[model samples]
Target: MSALPRHVSPARLPEVRWLRSSYSTGANNCVETARPSAGPWAGLVAVRDSKDPAGPALLFSPASWTRFADRIDRL
Candidate 1:
């Protein structure tokens, strides 16, 4: 198995649609996520700071992202 690159420039992503949790207040304090359906990132989940839409993004496999989120939710 190969690991996905830790980060990618959002600018390199083609047509990414970033989404934040509805639970997020409007303060830009939460992370945003997007699932890339094409390009090198196809099928990977991308995470970035809501306050910096143009910043670098961290890529995670769907399962890993889900696990991370579930753990955070339990806290």
Candidate 2:
């Protein structure tokens, strides 16, 4: 696996294009995801709390993310 920061401040990843689930409502109670478009962070996914757009974000490798989503789907 490629080395990646375990966590990063959202403000430091300004190039990320954050997205929330379509099922999310106006309460802003959901997690958001974004892919780093360029630089070392590219190809990995960044996830953050929708209610805390400027807060910390978790980083995940693409394969790791796919496995996580797959497990969630199976549940």
Candidate 3:
């Protein structure tokens, strides 16, 4: 359980396949998510602004993502 990096350059995670929620409108103004398929980032979730594809990504564990979503759902 080492501390995960808070930010990563999107270029450094080329293998990560970013996806946006289906709920996102055609304006493409939503956030995107990626699950690194290889390397040390494998199995962790990556999030970045869709408007800035090359921007830094925020990493989150599966459990942490679920909790955050749950909290949002309750709001």
Q: Lowest summed-lDDT stretch of 10 residues in model 3?
A: 10-19
Q: Each model's TM-score, in the order given?
A: 0.93, 0.85, 0.93
Clashing pairs in 1: none
> In order, what lDDT does every prediction score?
0.91, 0.87, 0.90
Per-model root-mean-square deviation over C-alphas: 0.9, 1.5, 0.9
When 2 and 3 are scored with lDDT, the better candidate is: 3
Q: Scored by Cα lDDT, where does model 1 land? A: 0.91
lDDT of 1 at 35: 93
C-alpha displacement of 30 in model 1, angstroms? 0.7
Candidate 3, residues 27-70, lDDT tens digits: the string is: 97999999998888889889999989988999999999889879
Model 1 lDDT per residue over 9-72, tens place: 9888879898899999989999999999988789999999999988999999999999999999
Which is superior by TM-score, 2 or 3?
3
Candidate 3 regions exceeding 4 Å error are none
